[model samples]
Target: MVLSLMNKDKFLHVVKVSMESSPYFQLVSSSDAYRAVPPGASAPVRIRFTPSKNRDYCHELVCLTARERIVVPIRAIGARAVLNFPAQLDFSKCPVKVSTQQTLLVRNVGARAARYQLRTQSPFSVVPATGALGAGDTVQVTVAFHPLASGAHCGSLAVCCSSGEERIHTKLQGEAVDVIVGLSTNSMEFDRTFTTMSSHRTLFIENKSNITAHFQWKAFAAEKEENEEKRRQCLLRPPKEVPQENFPEEKETEKVKGFCGDHSALLSSMDQEKMAKVKLMNQGAIDAPFTCLPSATNLGLLFKFAPEEGIIAAGGSQAVQISFRATVLGSFEEELQFSVAGSPRPAILTIKGSVTAPSLHFDLAELDFGDISFGFPYTQRCRLTSSSAVPLTFQLRMSDDGTQPAVDSVDQIRRDSDPAWSKGIHLHVEPREFTINPSGGTILPQGHQDIEVTLCSNTVMEFYRRLLVDLEGIGKGVAALIITARYQPLPGLPQALPCPGCAGCSCQGEVLLNALMLCQLDTRTAVLGQQPVVKSTFAPSPARSWALF
Candidate 1:
């Protein structure tokens, strides 16, 4: 009976449907396109039970109903690809050779009832002598190929699965690369031997490539003439264009130059090999100076050059624009150089401009320390101006906060000069002095306690002082601590706090008191005392009885 059931088509339907939809079923028959299902397929599938051995009638019936299974023979095929190189293939060379390794995946691609083998055609080899594919199963094979020549290469990949194998040809592709060379030249000439505050100049970029081309700007460099020692430091020049503003017939300037050069170092330290070079392509061209000295006297263009955007292509050339406003009046020239592609050699350009003080304004017009804590650090700032035609210096002083005196210790105060804009003016601040603590706390036996607060300023100077007090341990029976400050003058001023009067002024007042501020010593006692007492007056009553006796 089981043998008869094994021959039926019930198992075939089960295998077909299960293999088609089950994620568990990857390997499939060649008729089953893994990419898509055939036009006439059922939504849900049925399973079949096939028993090869013989069984009793009742047993056979039970097996058919209870032991039935939907077998979807999963057969799937996949390939692995990799690139390998031969000993002779060098990336630096004109042509490159590469090898590819391929691995094939073969799985059971058939109905539960069917089983088969995988085979391939020409130019390919399968690993095992004879491969057996099981229902709902998979296997892999390896293959290798080499491309001998240059240029783009193309080919096909093929595979076979159960239920009649089919070929899946994926186009194989690769390429060999090469390099092309080109040339360019940059020469500098001065229109006037003497450079002034206002100087007009044009920077030229020429294409020396054999073919017409579009090129990306790489970078530019400039050098000062050997004799002009004072003029070596130059400013970075703005580009060729500027936005227009209100006011008719305004002579608009296209660029603004920035100062450039190691003004801090001596001339003997600067040699050709160690000279500064601007890289335009990889090395950034000077867009603007990050920092400058306040006393810079000469001005000039400080910038790098680069091939214009797009490709440097074969031949065409592009020029970068350079212009400037003379900030300092003087005679100066600086040598500049920029590099193109891979060549170590650089293009040389020169910038000439003058430097004078621009209209000066204070960056830190004024400063408000806001409010500060006692014993904590605080700072205020104010910018000074040198536009008065002469370098000036001003002193900084801390004003009184009100009730409290400003800390006097000015001996530790320090001043700093801006390397670029301080212009002989120094910024200084005195060390912070003064602190606040709980003055006193008191509690009465019957009601709430009241506290009085006092503050001490480290200095006798008449300045504002700010302080913070934290209180604790004050119970509901105690009122908050109240604070008020008063000023008192000193007989004499100390040498360190020489800036002011010997008197200190009042500042912020009124703050609450707390229980933590109260120091408690508990007074507890258990008393034991001796005393004499008479429970009954037996002596007088007994006296009468004794008299009778």
Candidate 2:
């Protein structure tokens, strides 16, 4: 008997079926338990009935859900013969041009013997066309599957009883797979200088099969003993998780209950279920359905895919851009593995490259003082190295002119110089403000020099200056080392005071002079009064005094 179950709720509903206190009726085959049934959709539940005695049978089929439980009634006569067979046949995965076989057991569980005939469609044939089975007897029917193409193939098998009973039908399914993929190139090589800029290469991937194909590309260094040990150590470490403090207070309270409190325990269990479901959904979103390999991380190479990941239609192509930047100066080799869906082995693409050090190079492109206070001094240092085999002399000067020349221009100047700029050498920078010590220097092959630049400001404004360095023998227009600095205002300064002098003044005249004489009664008094003493002191000095008023 077939039971059609329909969902009426808006949200997803999970259904399960069971037989309640009915020994004669049993669940044979049905939709999976805990299966999600969408709203307004139906799922089939198949049940079988068998009787031990000759009489009418009655039973109840129980359907359980999260919202409610449904009871379905079962009624069948005990005296009838029933043919039992599997609901479907699955050949699973079969390689192209390969034949696979499966068996189905047919049984007669009834009061009398029965005659049955088996019929199947193309791509599938049964071993026995007709068979007879006594009561409580069984027969095995073998089905052969031979696929010619790559894809899912489907057919059906039907069984008929001579007693004019319901015809039993079972679905047949099998999948044939032969994946083919092509790449435009098998290897790539790059010669890059050690710089912040990255070198890029494009790989063309084409799908050759009729079915859509999925591909994943990864870059990894060649396997080494030390690298393997590091990988092992990385895997040994436990995964990091959100701290307990990040959890909600309610969740913490629930955790504290320890599943002892009835309400809190129920809620905690429900929350755990929801969290598990959410985690599963998130994982499904991140990982492709067919991918079985663990995701790789920290392979050292960076890559950008036009379409990070998606289905490539048959005869379609995709572009994958892989970029590499070497942090150190040396020759390095790496591998890029392309994993195609259903393929056991990955396609390995070789990548080999070398990074050469510049002949004359600076440790950094620019030095930044960030922010400096007024009247305060700030100093920074840069290392310049001559990596060539010959002695090189470099001259440093300020780009006093407002116009700053390009580094390429400095390089051109060096190239156009009398000695061809000493081979693989260039000048850079134009300084407008600030002071650089040891403006010029000479260094032996593979020698290093440190240049110190200091900046001091007295005004309350942004200060910018560039220091240019050039080769000693090269012309002035050649490259110059460019150093930059900026100054900020400092705090605390005396305010301006108002002037006491008149704004306009023109006074240049002297007043008439008057002389005064004083007569002293005593010599000590005369001395104390700051008067010039004369010998043989006389007391009549009143007539000798003259006054001008």
Best by lDDT: 2
10 residues in a row with least lDDT, candidate 2: 258-267
TM-score for all models, in order of appearance = 0.15, 0.20
lDDT of 2 by residue, 1-549 (tens): 788889875567778877754567767764335657888998888787777877667788788886468888777754555788778889998766566888777778877766888898867788888888888988888999878678999998898877546688989999987656778898888878578877878889877776565656544423455444433443343323335567665443322111000000001110011110101011111112111122253433332222334433222233343444334555555544444443344323334545543357777777777775433356888887876544557776655432232222212322233332222222233212355687778868789889887654322334444555565433343334555554432123112112233654311111111111121111111121343321111112221111101
In candidate 1, where is summed lDDT lowest over 10 consecutive residues? Answer: 540-549
Q: How accurate is candidate 2 locally (lDDT)?
A: 0.51
lDDT of 1 by residue, 263-346 (tens): 221111101011222222111222221211122233323332232232222222233433333323445565543334333333
Candidate 1 yields a Cα-based lDDT of: 0.29
What ranges in model 2 sit over 4 Å off? 1-78, 179-549
How many clashing pairs does model 1 include? Answer: 93
